[model samples]
Target: MSRTYVKVIPTVALLLIAGFSVSAWLVYSTSLGTDYSKYTFPLWTIPEGSHMYTQLRVGDLNGDGLDDVVVTGDYSLEAVFQNRTGGFENRTQILPSGSWDGFVLEDLNGDGSLDICALNATHDGTYLVTLSNSGTGAFAVASQYLLGPIRHVFPYRSHGSDVPDVGVYLLGDHNHIVLLHNNGSGHLTPDVYLSLTARNILDVLAADLDGDNQDEIITVQDNGNLTVWSKSASSRQFSNVSRYLDTVQAKRSAWLVIADMNGDGIQDVGLASNIGASRGVLVFLSGDSINVEQPIIERYYDYTWLGALASDLDSDTDTDIVLCTQQTVLVMENSQSGQIGGEIKFTGFITPHSPSVIALAGHPSPALIVLAEHRGWYDLNLIDLVVFWREERGILP
Candidate 1:
């Protein structure tokens, strides 16, 4: 398949003018700066016929030892781009994995290769399909099961399991959380399922909080109440549900990402809500298992709508947070002492839907991939992470 290439024009300059002041109402102190005097960003083109490339997952899918990406977009469009010498190349088209709106890629079979798990939307009925990697850039449905309507799908290593298993959060009045354990083959067996008292549940996340070496699932109800569920060792079920965060009223459109934000080695939580005009993002730093005494911190910005991703953006050995408005992408750096500050801005546009940080095969740092839908283009731009050396600036254009 031929890809669509575009001329990349970068306007970011290296200057220390206090800050760019993209958001005039930010409440945090920021001196975060970027030196872009050395180079231009590299663009990885998508097929011209592709609809909005909605979801992306990166891995060595074809066993070529090169990084490849699996993407799904409008009209159930799906394909995989193999990393080649120039950019990405795909000789043939990849069929959709049952046109599942949500999916994940992981080594589900304990085999040493990546596999694809896909599912249709919640409104499209209930089915979870597994496509096993045949080690030849092709996939075949190894197994499938009727999972009902699920809003989220993720693979995780449960408390005592060596291999990662699948967990899904059911949608609608189902109010159930289901787990499927991988049986060493590319198949999933029904392990545990639990029903909640409430309905309209949306998203779920798993992380090892409290540093007990056991992970707990974090979720939000449609009513804006944040809660967490833990696996009871004695009962062998996901029980012991408790309220985690007393969040704002505008939460139905909100989302949360987990990381060790406080440098505590324990995973903390951050919530990005599209509801509030004044409150930017709510961060609950890692604290006690039951409650962190003073956890909530509002890293203020002026944007009415926001979405966020938390990763080590600056290569500071600690994960930082990235937030994007309709027109700009902001990076919040984290010091080794867990201090979150020095926010900087990048001169680009990326929607908050799915802002991805991808570590390319050859680069020393990760690249930020975001779709500039506002620019009225079908392609996306990559912000390459380059190290700033004083001597290299003179040689690089």
Candidate 2:
């Protein structure tokens, strides 16, 4: 089968600057100073032709301190790489045949061991791939469930929108969100199927939107609607909690992330819309309720494309926005005054067609930002960890 290549670019450099600002705030106290001189390692490229798409997640599947990398490819194969002292070692390849689109790594079975949930392109379905952290990283196919049905599938093409349609060949259809639950006993099951009104569903994120301990589902539809769904404790089923926001005009592509953008205890939703005149918005909620007081932040960027992940790049309490434009990755800092701070652009960095993923430690320290680029052959690029001290201080050196 011929595989399609997508170039994953890092969002604008505003995220890097945000990381520096946060680090400076933590160390310097008053002045904003960063140390970019320290060099840990040079930029290196991983093996090529991995057909990697989307952001790569780093976690220790074997209980080792070193993080293990999990990535989905254009084909059905999902690769697991072990992070060694110098580079990454291919540990195992699990699935062999369908196109894998989206993936999440979590202890779904509640077993303390991390497993993977992967979305298949061929059938608009999801599969649970279980990894036994036993000695050598052995993997097993747990379960597979169809999310629902896709209205239309489109081929992978760059129609000026930052959102890439994995391998969908058509357009104009309703996509379903597939949530997988580990059923223990070495099995996985589909927990929720979310239907949306938009032509396409760009991304689905899980977060504690309300005070409830369970994570709520937040999906960004192609029609620019941010739909929030919560699971019932008794039924273990998902229902639409509320339509958080539908302020923006319908756009083909957008990225969604859940973060406390305003330093409030509640998590806020940040939508990075990659329309022709690229612009982003931050919607802060009082709680899990759809009552949004101020949805839009004052400062907006023109032609700023949204990156793969919308996260708290800077350690600031608010979630920062990352945009990868034609040239430069911009990182915007969160401001209480409703205005975003200055942007930090990283020159000389090439973004793959896939989105960049951020690796955060449970404690305070610099986190690794993984960018998988397409270099003729499939190769994974490891960008320098844009360090941050506090969530508010911004990106550090």
Candidate 3:
């Protein structure tokens, strides 16, 4: 497969001055300082042939121990396997052109191979489609269950089960969470409601935030509040709910990422606020208990962050923050105290959405992959799978 490599081009830098003059009571401390233009970002774009791409999932699909990509779109389901040259092969269409939306990659059948659980929206209704992988990059339809319109499907292990279940945000009428439990037979059974009252569900993340042995389901709502649902020992279901980010500082929450931002053992929550006057990213330093009142706040005056991911960008054992805007990619180094230190800006991404991280087989650092749509030659519409193989200074081949 052919790939497009564009040389590093310097983009116009907009210096964000610290301290907001809007509110005097609000102590405006800037973690991301005024230094915007420092290093050139190294990246390459691969034309995966647009299908109105919606989501991308990474895993070892071909059993090569390399992270392969499975992409879902409005009219296509495709897989791009990583080759030995630290690149990808031509994308293979996993299913015929269809209305595919949110999907996840996991071992559904317990055959040790990763399977696909995808949501397909059709003219009739939305359906949960399960595709069984043959451990050789080949997939076939295992089963399909008619479901309501869903936003996304994620891997969740419910009730201490060995099999990984699938959870999704069931939208329309009343928004809530519904789980399609894997019956250990490679088939998903629906109608399991985790939270019937979850309103305006924007994103869902599964992690053990409170040091409990059970995994907690964290959901970000459109109202800029976070709800954490933990499994009840007596009920055997996720019934215990705790709400966070219900502060005046948080408004119109764009997205949330969970990781040990500091060297602290507990998992911290990083949130990106997209709207309101104080729009920026903040890190919640979690403790043995849920801390909802206070967060280590950081604000960018002019830039609007759409999405963010927490990862150790320099392999320094401390988690760094990577926020995506329409124009540039922002990297904030994490101090040991869960505060931002230095920042790097990578420009030249058009309409970038859902930034992800994947470590190739022979690469020393993980690569940042983003789904971007831009116009190609002859003014044709193109969706490019843009990959950044570098950090602040380190570059990958």
Candidate 4:
């Protein structure tokens, strides 16, 4: 070969190598350009055996800037765990007798101080709504409301089965809901019981479903029915605005949550159905009447009985769904495009019976608070509050 020909061949080889190098560099840059910082994981599990039946985070619970947790357990025992330097310290305990079903923390009395609403089920099959607050590390009950006798009050009895058994170990019973309203006198009014029908009501939540300023009540019946009751603007009375039955042919109990899933300003409903085959339904409301139009149904593999469902995961502006099965937890994203995304599996964790999960929005980024019973205990065992974010380019900062 001639010298010029050899030089031309070498030049071509260099050009080919340069082209490949540039292509690889471009591909690597594009791959690293993604914003995975939003998926980072930072978890803080509450002290073991706190028996946190319900957990709510509210700011200035002890006149401090940090958010404090209000937890409730059996025997109407309500405790306020103050958010100290890094961990929680028991602050106060209130009303230790009737077993509690659900709880809420708010300034119900409009007193600038935070108060609590406890839904207590008495031993003799009666329901009591207790309102209390913490003063100098002790609880002081302000008022009590005797919510009429709950229809099926026995524990562990099937829905609509009035067995009338008084065994404390029985767990399947209809629990009453507790809703708090402030009387604006530094004292919370009695909890208003909102039971539409005599059927077993599973979960109840309060949110502004419509664009109205007042908050509405969203209840999920054990028979897989979603009911939205709007609070009257003037009278403060609850009126049944709309109801939606599971279009799917299945009899199931549902755990429901209300949030703006589609970022449409209006709150949408997320229902986790424990039907024959476990599945979840996301219903988006349109207009101001709780008119649910878009229904997205997602069925999980295996016997995935969904216990608790929460939204706003991944902090993507659009809401996501977290489903707690007996063994694993699945996180489903709401793409807002009418199509559901794949799942983020959280394994190696036990979701106790009646597990409750909520997104903690009080932090810089959102975290998840999961309330579950211990491996052997019947009461609440562990409170795992985890904050997650994503990192890109192998750097979290």
Model 2, position 205, has a per-residue lDDT of: 58
Return whichever of 1 and 3 wins on TM-score. 3
lDDT of each: 0.53, 0.46, 0.60, 0.44
Query: Could you give the C-alpha RMSD of every candidate to the true structure, in order shown?
Result: 9.7, 10.7, 10.3, 15.2
Two-way TM-score contest, 1 vs 4, winner: 1
| Candidate 4 structure quality by residue, lDDT tens digits, 182-265 | 445433333355445535666555555665555666666666677777656556356788877765545465666655644556
* Clashing residue pairs, backbone N/CA/C < 3 A, model 3: none
How well does candidate 3 match the true structure in TM-score terms? 0.76
- Where is model 2 poorest over a 10-residue stretch in terms of lDDT? 25-34
Between prediction 2 and prediction 4, which has the larger lDDT? 2
TM-score (all chains, Cα) for each model: 0.72, 0.65, 0.76, 0.62
State the RMSD for candidate 3. Answer: 10.3
Query: Which segments of model 3 are wrong by more than 4 Å?
Result: 1-53, 245-253, 276-279, 283-287, 348-368, 376-380, 390-397
Candidate 3 on 21-136: residue-level lDDT in tens?
Answer: 11111111111121321221212223355444356676789898776777766677888776664556757888766688778788988888989988888887788899999999
- Please give, for residues 1-397, the per-residue lDDT of candidate 1 as tens digits: 1112112232332322235222221111011122222222222333355433255555677777655556544334244443433234563345433444567778877767888887754354767888788776677778888877777887756756656788888777777888787877767988888677766665676777766656677777656666777775445577655575454454545666776765667777666665455344444545345354345354444553345666554444666666655545555666535456564544332223223332211112233232222112322342222222222112222
| lDDT, model 3, position 75 | 70
lDDT of 2 at 208: 63
Model 1: weakest 10-residue lDDT segment is 25-34
- lDDT of predicted model 3: 0.60
Q: For model 1, what is the alpha-carbon lDDT of residue 339?
A: 54
